[model samples]
Target: MTLLDFVFRLSNRVFRPYPFCHSRPDRSLCYHRRYFGLCARCTGMYLAGCLMILSFPFRGELLSPTLNIILGTVLLLPGGIDGTTQMFGSRESNNFLRVVTGLFLGVGVVLFAEGVLFILIG
Candidate 1:
């Protein structure tokens, strides 16, 4: 097969629903004529997480380790609660809320990881 055809086939396989992403049309973002492989929340999480990681080299040690941990935990709460409630059928969530909470979760995870790393290394 041609390279372009191969790439298309590979993308098709990679973007299939389930496991990584639900790929539900109602919950996914569309670009051009295609829907994203991941749902809105996952897209937000991945986007923010990648951005945060990219900014690591430029970050300063302004916040104390304890403060980092506290802040991280606080940031994580929204996503955690939202996901848990949805999972247990307590409430249904919308895409906007999902993306926002996912963004928080992404940053929170990085901060929490930094805290853990500090504890481990120091």
Candidate 2:
């Protein structure tokens, strides 16, 4: 490979992933593992974010900012709340709760991203 290609690959390895959500027992999946190095929900959130980005091209003239904001909140809130609560030590949440929270948070993230893109594009 060329020197530029080698450098690009090295840089990507050094600073590409944006790891975020993580479980105590799964350290390998932590941030920096590359590309939302997290559990299932985190993975979902990342995907949602990508989806939001991908959806940017679909904005019609009739779509309202309020609707977009609502959708974004719905997508992210449950998971964000659950994660924040757990992080703050409110209580030890069970696995089912974790999964549900993660799922919601992921959706919320996607929604938020879409909203931002819509506002900016509009």
**In model 1, how large is the Cα lDDT of residue 25?**
69
What ranges in model 1 sit over 4 Å off?
Answer: 1-18
Q: Write the per-residue lDDT of candidate 1 for residues 1-122, one digit (tens) a residue.
A: 66655544554468663487776767766554456666778877877888988998899666777787888999999999998999899989998998998899888888888887887888
Cα displacement (Å) at residue 65, model 1: 1.8
State every prediction's TM-score relative to the real structure: 0.79, 0.54
Q: Alpha-carbon error at 1 in model 2, in Å?
A: 32
Tens digits of per-residue lDDT, candidate 2, 6-49, equal: 54455445434533544333422332333222454554555656
Q: What 10-residue stretch in candidate 2 is worst by lDDT? A: 27-36
TM-score of 1: 0.79
> Number of clashing residue pairs in every model?
0, 6
